[model samples]
Target: MNTKFSKLSFTIAVSTAMIASASLASPTVVSFSDATATSTSGSFVADNAIDKNKNTHWEADTDGASITARFGSCQRVDDLVLNWYGTNKYTYSVQLSKNNGATWTTVVSKTSGKGNKNAQNVTDQAANAIKVVGDTDSRLRIDELKVNSLGSTNGCTSSGTSNTSNGENSGTSNPSTGEVSGGNAQYPADVLDLSKWKLTLPISLNSPPNSNKATEIKQPQLKTYTNSEYFRLNAAKNGVLLKAIAGGARTSTNTAYPRSELREMQGDGTESAAWSCTNTDHGMYLEQTLLHTTTKKPEATIGQIHDSKNDLVMVKYVGPSFANGSTDIGKLEARFNNDNITKLLDSTYKIGDPMTIDTAVTSGGNVTVNYKNLRSGVRSSTGTVKMTGIIGSCYFKAGMYIQACSKTDIYNNTNTVCANKNLSANKYETDPYAYAEIEVRKITLR
Candidate 1:
């Protein structure tokens, strides 16, 4: 304890203090040379070596033998860094295996030549055991090998200082953490809109008007449902839930009847007198449900009637028929292709009318249907029907239904007798006409 102690005593005191401070200040950097070389029965040789800069480190030499450093039983190192000098490019690939090297997966492969000393980061989305494999150029030397954990660690905190592991800095946080955080997190623009959230619309909205003029005049304009608005509006307020009714007629009579009477009798018995006196009116009705099975929304419907002896007629009838039987109707007709109709029906028509032709094989073919007569009318029986041009191959389905209702009175006074007696005296003949047609086709992409 004397003020001037011996040199040995002074040196020992200083050394003791230095050791204690070093232990508390930093983690002990255990050089690979100090640690025992872990040996396995495999071809890998684990050893400690000094680098060209005299840095002590661990090394795995696959020099003549393949070497791998295994971690614990289940998790293997995912990344490694090697320091070496070499000539004649050396190619090596990193392999990984979860099953103790039973099956190795190649993660990274690189070639190094003279003046090559760098850290390589090996990342494998799927890897368990990480090691290096040498290619044709076998003169390989690895000065240092460090393993790194692959995925993100949830509840672990790394020492604040940068530590090189798997050739990447592994620490609690990096200087550019803010940039990384901002780049990874993003939200969609429409997520905040509540108006777009619910699929159903409010009931206060109005339903749209029907496209059929005959149906429109007899039906209230407000009462008629429009396909456009019906989806959002409540079904009860839309209109009457009536079945779809449609038909066509061919008459030699050259007179254009007034529109008012024609709209009143559409699909009903009000025009029995006119229907019986003329021998030329003919048509059919094709109807389906309005709402789709998946959407439950009002949708446009299509109807087609094929007459083998006449022309194949396809009609797209909009709702809300006219009071005067005068409304714009979309019609298409063409000569039928027996083969094409068969295939279209086979694919879409499951429950409806069967196809007259086999639709399975003839996917590409031409068909035609002629529109000999077309007309818009208000009363059920009397309206100006025009003859439209023929439509060909416009429809995917070919087979449809056609029914003929003919009113015949041998005595020309049938109309007068019915008016006076108020009795059903007109001779009515109904017959089912058979024609080849395809089923309805869905225009949705598969």
Candidate 2:
């Protein structure tokens, strides 16, 4: 043979030897089941019980017979053992339920033998009974079947007590109804009885003025009381003197105007201050004018004085040289008692400092006035000062002119004295006058 051929043959032999060594080094077991039965009886037969010799043996057959056991009143059952013999095929299943023979639930199913073992526990909460059903050939056999309860008590009690595997007690009790007067009072709905005391009737506003006269009526009629329980009536405009009535008899009469007492209480309640406009036509205009005039001036002086009896005098006015015309003036002084004025004075003012007015105007044209600066002898310390009144003046004028001249005497005398004096004259004149003024005085503060 050629040398190359011999080398090739040697290589093939070495490869074959390595493959044989690998196959011998490791082995594996493949499991399968063959049908074989040892039990002849169709029920729980002792000869079919599983033992060590029959642990791996089992059977499967066309006949669907089974071995079953009643678990009694147990919530859960487990740890069932099944032993088989010989290499064979077998099918098995476990059934369970809560109701005694009425219903059942399947827990486990398996095939046995054919070199495979048959062993398992049937664990289920509703398993009150178990049925092991299987079929097999003569070569397979069962040696034992064992089972045990899951919990110490094995089942639920009639009183709803269920013991867990960890020894915890899960017991439920009925709920109790609450008591009134130490005993429960039954009511259709959850409610507290409030029938003992009477409820007060709701109060109402006074009747509106001139309900029938459309011209006199200024606003739409509103309910006397927006919320009323005992009696309710729509606003009436017929001037019939309507009232909140019960059983056709008047319970409360409506007034033509709001009661003064209620008006006073309105200050504390949710009701706003009663706005009364003498004439709606000019109401807004007059209100704005009043607000502007009443506004306090900046740089107003304030002072206080004490009498022999120790009573205090307060005075307020514009600066000494300034006139109180229609326009708001600065340097007005407001005075109060020494004690009172001292409290009013803030950190800003010294004895001769000009007083200041803090004025605020609201949307409704309501004006608020505050006076600052209180001095000693120069100004009283306890008094009221306000924009007393407004006096407005307007002026108008027409221009005119007049002229004078003389020439008749000169012409006659000139005729006698050689008529040389020429008589001529010219003149011009003018007149003009115009003025406007307004005055407003301070009113005392109340």
Residue-level error in angstroms, candidate 2, position 434: 99
Cα TM-score per model:
0.21, 0.21
lDDT of 1 by residue, 153-246 (tens): 1222211211111222211211111001111112110111111111111111223321111222122222222223211122312111222211
lDDT tens digits, residue span 1-446, model 2: 01111000000000011234355222121110111121221221221232223332222112344433333344344444444444445665555434332234566666652324444555535444344555443222234433433232244322211111111112211111000110121220111111111111112222442211111101111211212222221122100111111111111232111000100002222333222211111000000001011111112112222222221322233321222223433333333333243223233333223332222222222222334231221211112222112122111000000001111111121111111223232110010001111110111100
Q: How many clashes in each candidate?
A: 50, 54
In candidate 1, stretches whose alpha carbon ends up further than 4 angstroms from where it belongs are 1-45, 49-64, 73-80, 86-88, 111-115, 118-128, 135-139, 150-446
